[model samples]
Target: MSEKIFSYLEVHAVDHCNNNCRWCNNHSPFCPEREYAAGEYIPWMEKLEKKGIEYDMISVMGGEPFLHKNLTGFVLELRRRFPRKSLAISTNGFWLGEEQIESYQMLWKLTDILFISLYPNLLRGLKDGGDVTPLLHKITKHNPHLKIDLRQKQTFRMIAYSEEPVEPNTFCGTSECTTLLADGRLARCGLGGYAGYSPNVGEAFRSSKHMFFDLNRKFSKGEFWNWRRRWPFDACYHCDSYKWRETNWKAEKGKRRRLDLELEHDRLAGGRLMALGNFTQAESLFRRTAEKYPLDAALCNDLAVCVSHREPLEALAYLAKALEIDPDHDDARANLRRLRHVLGRGTENARPEVCSADAGVR
Candidate 1:
């Protein structure tokens, strides 16, 4: 497949998992609205082909990939698109149905490897009295050519919930993991993407590394190779397994969470003021909110927005603060450039469309 753009590609056919393992690596059990349409993968495939991004080994995973009705169709499409790429599916093996045996056989034919993570929680619901041996025999009897790997025990370390944010760990397996999410976001790892942590807070993905790429978007091949050589994404520090070997591996109390209540309130109040055409009150609220959460880039950017027209210097200060907090904040950077033009600092550029008194500040 054109020498492979990536070493491995993890394609999640569905986000929500059927079995609730204590610590699913991707946290599939806790994922909400986990299902993906069979058609969702087509555009992504098209984009990959258009960009010439290929993978040597593609892992089709999910809460359980078998849960998706059109999984075989998706697999067929993968084969059709990239015939040389080796395909594999990681499943919990709990929900095999009598009606879908043929579909399973077809999937086995298309895929090169099948990894069944045999969790006890899934064993309870097995139709064959919780015995995986008979199921394995049955599956092999159907397609002897398929290579099956049965993992009775967990492979990776588990990250548990904690009351507060934990320190960044350095030894995570996800450093090598690249996940192509169902919604077309090519994330560095599943933990950073699915957990919904803020990039600025250091618990989530790096603003520069992990991003949502559209179908027509151009990716830097050199950057991709450079990132591949890097051991871990900056987001890995937020994970418990970052340096599992060195750290005292103890299950701590509490969960990974983000605290943003005060900031939300202030932003909402300011938004209402802006909507009501009360720029003065909006600016005051934004300023107070920015002071309360100086580290929050959104608040700083909002404050800059409020003061952009009436107080250009104050707006520049607030924008600068926002940039300091999040250097990758696009809106703040764009506004800074726009405000500079209004002040005629960099170039003798014409006044922006919104420089007039009646222009919308938001």
Candidate 2:
């Protein structure tokens, strides 16, 4: 047996979404771009097949995979391409109906797991308004062999640009994910696809007509293992998704220590620069520290003061950013109100220059 164990393949078949959920991390409701091409899907599958690289599970997700014009055809192709592999799809479960359930018969025959997203507010009382209950009942009635994985819709807050937290036990980390984008990029994780930060799988497979023999060669060798291992953990650490749930109980204190070290580094660096009267550098360091440690109101207040001395007009902007990061920053709030008064006075009289010149002397 080959010691090599490959992870699940996550394919983003469509970029468009219909529901505008409040807690969506990827900003799916606001997503305006559609990059998936129906014609290129089969060829991409074929390329993966040619590689000895067989996926343990193929996951189809998007704004909603059901929204794809050729969803039935796509599911069929996935079945045909990966005969032995299990198929899974994540959906908001909005478009499922009696006819849709009938269409799913083909998928039920081939699919092993059906991961349905239950949006409580969207499907609260309506019997047929995208509720997975009807579909689950129908699917169970038809195919007892299929395993159903019903997941509750959880809030994913974007703490940073790259990371967001899913519910506990939901995230399996990068080791268990192989994400496929419509543009022929293969990501190490499903989140990477939504974040537009995945690695390139191969040359763009344009259509199903062309045989992607070369593309197959690229995916066959598992070079992505090394790539995934090198992915920055700092980006994720600052993410709201890196919550207490994801922390390993054994390594909790250690992880907290590391995070504290990172925060301390930023704090010390910012403080040293501020003491030296280098407001610009200090401001940059403090901004990073604020993002990582949003609970630190002192950092926010201090950073606000540094920016206020240089750019009084930007004082409000920095203060606002600080409060957004740390709402309980009383010092920041008080300083912000005071600075606004100074700004008003400056506008009426003369624009106040930053004290960078006299800062060094002080």
Give the best candidate by lDDT.
1
RMSD of every prediction: 19.9, 20.2
Q: 314 in model 2: Cα distance from truth in Å?
A: 65
Clashes of each: 13, 2
lDDT of 1 by residue, 63-167 (tens): 577666567787888777778878888987654433224225556678888898765544454566665676566666777877888875433355544334455
Give per-residue CA lDDT, model 2, range 247-322, as digits (tens): 1112111111223433543555555556556677667656655654543546656666787877765565555555
| Candidate 2 CA-lDDT value | 0.53
Instruction: Please tell me which predicted candidate would have the highest TM-score against the true structure.
Output: 1
Q: Mark the 10 consecutive residues where model 1 has the least summed lDDT.
A: 250-259
